[model samples]
Target chain A: MIPLDETDKNILNAIQFDFPLDVKPFEKLGEQLEIKEEELLRRIQRLNAAGAIRRIGPIINTKKLGGVSTLAAVSVPEANIDKVAEYINQYPEVSHNYLRPDKYNIWFTVSADDENRLNEILEDIEKETDCPLINLPTVRLFKIGVMFNIR
Target chain B: MKDIYIQLLRITQDGIPFTSRPFKDAAAELNISEEEVVDLIRKMQSEGIIRRFGASIGHRVLGITANAMCTWNVPDERVEEVGKIMAGFSEVTHCYERPRYPDWPYNLFTMVHSYTEEDCIRTAEDISKATGIEDYKLLFSEKEFKKTGIRI
Candidate 1:
């Protein structure tokens, strides 16, 4: 892990929330931090190259975009984890998938334009993996955003 | 959805290009003014279509190695109240009230991130203390199969 300094922390805190939607966002960001635009961009590039800044962009609301998502978990045997994970990752709709240390080891979040498509993708995944999957759609989304205040 | 907004989403979904004049570059591609791009984004924000517009930081790179998906077996009656409290914590990234199954009884799910497993446990304990819901299980991710932002 790269040790982050005060400036990097400040930059992460700033960009993790709202990035300026202006033409020269970096310039505005730098102005806020009392840094030069060129310096700010350079730091951001370094951060990106170092894998700190994954992407600087808009976080689209899937539901607002007429999409539906569900959290699905499947209990994969120890031997078939790799093969099953590969099969599950083949679907573009499976955005976040993880092998959790639980009975239902493989957990994933799948999103699609609608319920039908989402189910179709999940169905295909179940068929391919030959595993019974539990679909736990959000009953109520209390919070969906994550902004780690890296101070 | 307007054609222009669709085009804007398509262009911005991958991420806004890191450049001096990102909006201008996008505007030039879509044949729209920079102000138009900004205006559309602002509108989308107001409409709750854009949850956030910013840099998606890689937490693991920042030494936040531990991620625990904590599920609470809260009572159905108090699920909402507890969920609201859990959602207020900075460490609680994602919180939701999901339906319970016949075999699985966890109803409230939360994703907690920290630099260590102890930190994650502390966060979960804090949530438990705050909500007074102690029946919970934290499932740590052994391996990340895939992690990507959906381009919806």
Candidate 2:
């Protein structure tokens, strides 16, 4: 486990929303927390190693990136669920996949460069997996984004 | 540790309290001290089990330009390297490798964000160039019926 002091917490909280777009963003963050850049980087690295920080990077707006996103579901035989999932997991288009206790047992989110490619991939998966595909793309995007609170 | 971590996930997925004293209110509901809740959250963050405790923004309201899910046919030998490289992009969110079906030819998947569809396409093209993977697919979101953090 990683040890976090009040300063570390403060630094994390400050960066979550206000990650500066500067030459040395961490340096600015360190200045805010009254800590050395080297020390702050060290702490962040330690926290990441401990899994506290999954990543330290900019959060971009994907929707603005000119692509389509969708939540797709597939009904796979229980016996072949793992195999199918393994196959689905091999694609980079799939963002998240889960095994739900529903008729649509396997659900995942797919984002692609365009609508055509997305449909093509889905159709391919359906044909190969021998499982029916239910393409439930987002009709309305309700909400998206991650919030990391320090306190 | 497992149980507590699950509880933490449940709490976050259920949604953080939307109040000035959100932690205090959450503690009250869970029958724990506010201080305890805060401590637990801190611990969870430090442990990396809980990546971050924050808000889920409304992209539509913010007028996001575009977003798409791009899948690549990464060789099994270089899956990890490609995944790491894809994750390095600030515009790419939710990068993971899913299994490919006979019908589903591509394997590496990444979600890219931009201000417009053209931008997303350009980014995907750039990624294609960078990764040197010619065969891949792009799936755009048609509708988001329900999107929420799982409470389990």
Candidate 3:
């Protein structure tokens, strides 16, 4: 892992939320960090290449965009986990899939444009995987955001 | 909302181009002024349709290898109180109240991130101690099957 300095940490923290939207957003960001615009851009590029910055962009609210989503879990035998996960992952709606340590070993969040599309994907997965799945849709979204202090 | 605004969203769903004049590039493609694109984005933020404009990081690549979906079986009467407490923690990134199922009694879910598995477990224990809710379980991700932002 690349060791992050104070400047890098500050940059990461600032860019995580409310990144400037000006013609020269990086320049504005550099002003906040007390660094040169060129240097800031270079560091951001390096960070992106290093896989630290997954993507630099606007995070659209899926629900606001008329998408129906739910958290679902399934249990696959140990031997068929990879194959089953691969099959489930083929659906574009099935995002944030993970293998958890529990009876419901495979958990994932799926999102689709509408209720019909969402159910179609779920039904397809259940039939293909031949595993009973549980759907745990969020009744109330109290909070949804992730920000880590690099410092 | 105008058709132009929807077009802009389509252009930006993946991300803003990584360039100095990113908005300008977007405007050029849509045959609109850069100022208009910025104005629309600003308007969207004010409307709460866009939560925040920012960069997403690979937390695992940054040494945050452990994550747990900590579920709490808080009573219906106290779910709101306990949920607010859980949501207050910096380590608790996503917190929600979901419907309980048969043989699955957890009603509250909180996603916690830590540098190690021990740290994650400790966070879960600390949450329980703070909330005074004994019925809880920590589900750690043994493997990441897939992860992608919701596409509109």
lDDT of each structure? 0.87, 0.62, 0.84
DockQ each: 0.77, 0.05, 0.70
Q: What is candidate 2's CA lDDT for residue A81?
A: 81
Query: What is the DockQ (computed on Cα atoms) for candidate 2?
Result: 0.05
Q: What level of docking quality does candidate 1 show?
A: medium
lDDT of 2 by residue, B31-53 (tens): 87766776776666566555555
Candidate 2: segments with Cα more than 4 A from true spot: A1-151, B1-21, B28-33
Better of 1 and 3 by lDDT: 1
Give the C-alpha miss distance for residue A76 in model 2, angstroms: 15
- Per-residue lDDT for A43-107 in model 1, tens only? 88888999999887778887877889999999888999999999989888889999996889999
Q: Which structure is stronger by TM-score: 1 or 3?
A: 1
The local lDDT score (0 to 100) that residue B123 gets in candidate 3 is 91
Candidate 1 residue pairs that clash: none
Number of the predicted model whose lDDT against the real structure is largest:
1
The digit string of per-residue lDDT tens for model 3 on B1-152 reads: 55775677778876665667778878899888888888888888787777777888878778988889998899999998999999988889899998887868899999999898899999998999999999999999888878877655
Candidate 2's displacement at residue B56, Å, is 1.5
